[model samples]
Target: MEETSKLQAEAKPMIYPSNGKAKEALINEKQPEVRPVRGSALRQVLVAFVANIGTINTGMVFGFSAVAIPQMQMPNSTLPIDEDQASWIASLSSISTPIGCLLSGWMMDALGRRVALLLVEVPLLVGWLLIATAHNLPLLYAGRLFVGFGSGLVGAPARVYTAEATQPHLRGMLSALASLGVSFGVLLMYALGAALPSWRHGAGVSAAVPLVALVLAAVAAPETPSWLIAHGRPKEARCSLARLRGDVCDIDGELDQLTRGTSISAGDGKSRSDMAASKRQTEKPEPLIKTLFKKSSLWPLGILVAYFVIYQFSGVNAVTFYAVEVIRAAGIGGGDSDYLTAVAMGVVRLAATAAACILMRRMGRRPLTLISSIGCGVTMLGLAGSLAYLEPGDFSILSWLPIVCIFGFTITSTLGYLVVPWVMIGEVYPARVRGTLGGLTTCAAHLSVFAVVKTFPYLQHLLTRPGAFCFYGCVSLLGSIFFATLLPETKGRTLQEIEDYFTGVTPTLGPPKENKKKIKSKELNGSVPV
Candidate 1:
């Protein structure tokens, strides 16, 4: 209670808009030129873009198997694969992604966000190059593992950085931008798969993306102010916040808010014993078991685990890794191969994600997720029904029905379950455990992906297409109910507010509320600002 009150008191200077007038009055006396700055939001976008550019490569890492595995199955192909080998090839990256997620969690806090962002490109570049030149199963396996590891490394830092750097109003859009980058990357790979003669050439071309992301991170991205302050570098934190917010924002006041929000104290005039106690408190690490059991850590982790399980088992990844196979099974192209249809589905997913970025700015996370979950369930069931009943030579009549269901599944999944989980990853956890818990959440998610992707073929064989999709539909519907019950609405809430809700410091997870007592007290004193 004492800690929460201290945090609230520290946060009061910046959480409400009343401070704006005082800051404006102070700025007016200094310089008129610095009073207004345009495009602060644009600066936030630039940082977000840099942080997430690597996700495009992560997308390609996922989409690669969808395109590459089909090509490897060709009879005349130089590197051919049987069914077992193909499943391994398709699911290998997912197997190694958890390792990357675990490592980046430590590195995001131990090293820095910028360093993690920059270093992830190394494994990605090496992996793609290995795949491009691979001639055997071992080499292909090695490449996929490396790519998956790099993909894991990206989730923590990109979302964490974007969440900490941007303001509350712009945070959703920027954080969702990571998902948008992924959608674009998947679309790019699908188009490349359709156009390129060989998967090897596509791998070669994909190497350039991480290289570009590396350069962007090195040249443009700033270390998040929250990180800098937490690490005891207030000066750098001020500068970073300045760079992210531009001249119009009150960098000092925002920094103070950030300090309070992150639960770090300034320690201004404390005695030697007090300072020593504070140092001991902050430096002493909690046991992993205890940390995991804490309400702050446990609650958000539960939410994420439930959300990610739904995300993977709902067959989004099954469809992603096996787009061509799904399309073929749907009887599209009259029993012929069709990469273009996969590319078109990619286009639809990309467009839907783009819309999600806009809608995330306006809608609550819970509603969007519920809508997406329900939509995905309906689409999957629809596809199952269409696949079960459609007869041969019915291409002219209801052939497009299965395709429409598939497209509908893609659209609905992308809007909420696919994107919201990632956004919430950066939002829900408290700063003390954000890195560790974020990594674990991401690690668990990829493990689920691995299970889904690896077992997809077996599931299909055992149950047939309609039965498998029917299972997925049922799971998705149940998942919607789970999310609807527990998922708190996080739209327009600050990170501190969200953290407080999870910790039970506050009863609600809505937007920050003004201190009405303070305003009333000031009004009684006749000193309240107009």
Candidate 2:
């Protein structure tokens, strides 16, 4: 009885707004009513599928370079590419990716989530259409560049939209769709590359993919409730949440949390800090540029950027993009049979990524990531040793070694390295800065792709193919150590909870009466916070 009396005495009203209008809205306005779905997974699936469509388009475009490079170098090619041109063709996508990423953040925030995704579809369609009809290298390069732009654009939106739209239970698997879509797209392109008469024919047919994504996104998908609320449309946020939940009651709790934590350091009185510290942190709005430079913000960015750097530098791109060459160098098939090997590798990647979707929810992010990095490191090193130590011509018995190594790299890399970085990128940041950081991370990812792809030939020349694999193995092993030590466990927490962790706030707290009374007294004193 005394505890209840003390708790009531200690309770204090917190004024969340800095201005009169917001204060009036919170105090006087009633929440809009809406219905929600109970135990229905449809809304989650639809949003994920819509976001996945953009990723699929991105994947197809990315995979386009891998298969089309071979055809462009063939004799009688309409736009035959030289060694230098082929390298550029492979690397050009990386060059244009950051531009796309920049646009993605703008479109997502300025226009809308749906609008940003629609923008992704248009460039992919046009890029492929141009590729199909192009008679010269310039047109071909331009088309490839456009496809890359579309791909880069999808990266930011996919992470932001999926994270915003789905519940915490589904976040890991759904967000993983971003990476999975890319894997499937690569698989799709490989399938088409094998079955079609030519690369041009395959690309021409693949243009239909984004066209479908465009229609579905325009007609069916809804903007996320979180995005709507952040943009100051609470009524719309309610409506979207209702549709997303579909007959579930009491959705207001989540809606309220979403509204409160819209910024990076949402300094409501519930935080672990003292009332003075809370007031000081939220007193003045931090500028975006200033926020980017702060140690707290920069630390997460560093982790995300390094994750992607490790993902690309683990030699995944070098192995996948130059699969045929690697196999040939290792004395697999004499001529073009390595194309078949590339296709098989794509299937393996798709399957492994799909498996990761299920396993991530059960086992959590950190464990799977550690396993993937270490496993890939070991496989790449084995490939290196076999190539460096054995004579290709004399060791006919070990011709299968390269195939085994490539398959091993594909399976191990996809299990964690290919998928987990995107998942972490989605989960680790505050919503206020998610779009900006996402763009920066995407830029880092593509830049690394360019770096590894452009330099692989040189590295192979300097250290031989075996030594190149050895170097990549070293990178993978080092990355594994970082993953084990640095990454946080975010398997089942809500977005608001994750954001609080970054802000040094605990998800759960119990305030002592003395501390609560002290805070209440501070607020009642009415001094302007610094």
- Among the numbered candidates, top lDDT falls to 1
Per-residue lDDT of candidate 1, residues 230-348 (tens digit): 78899999888888878565566567767655321112345332343355446756665576679988999999988999979999999998988888888776323478888898999
C-alpha TM-score for every candidate = 0.86, 0.84
**lDDT score, candidate 2:** 0.76
**lDDT for each of the candidates?**
0.84, 0.76
Clashes of each: 0, 7
Which candidate tops TM-score? 1
Write candidate 2's Cα lDDT for 1-530 as tens digits.
Answer: 99998776665333456678877888666655433312246778777888778788767766776788877777877678877787787778778888888777777767778788787888889988988888888888898898888888988888788888887668888888888898998888878887786888977988998898889888877888877876789989988777776646446755765665532233344544444244544666577677667655676788878888997888998876676677777777665566776788788899999999988888888888888788889889989988877785765657667668878888888878888888877777666577777778787888898899878878988998889999999999999878887777778666655655566655332233435565445435522221
- Model 1 residue runs over 4 Å out of place are 1-39, 262-292, 334-337, 511-530
Q: What 10-residue stretch in candidate 2 is worst by lDDT?
A: 521-530
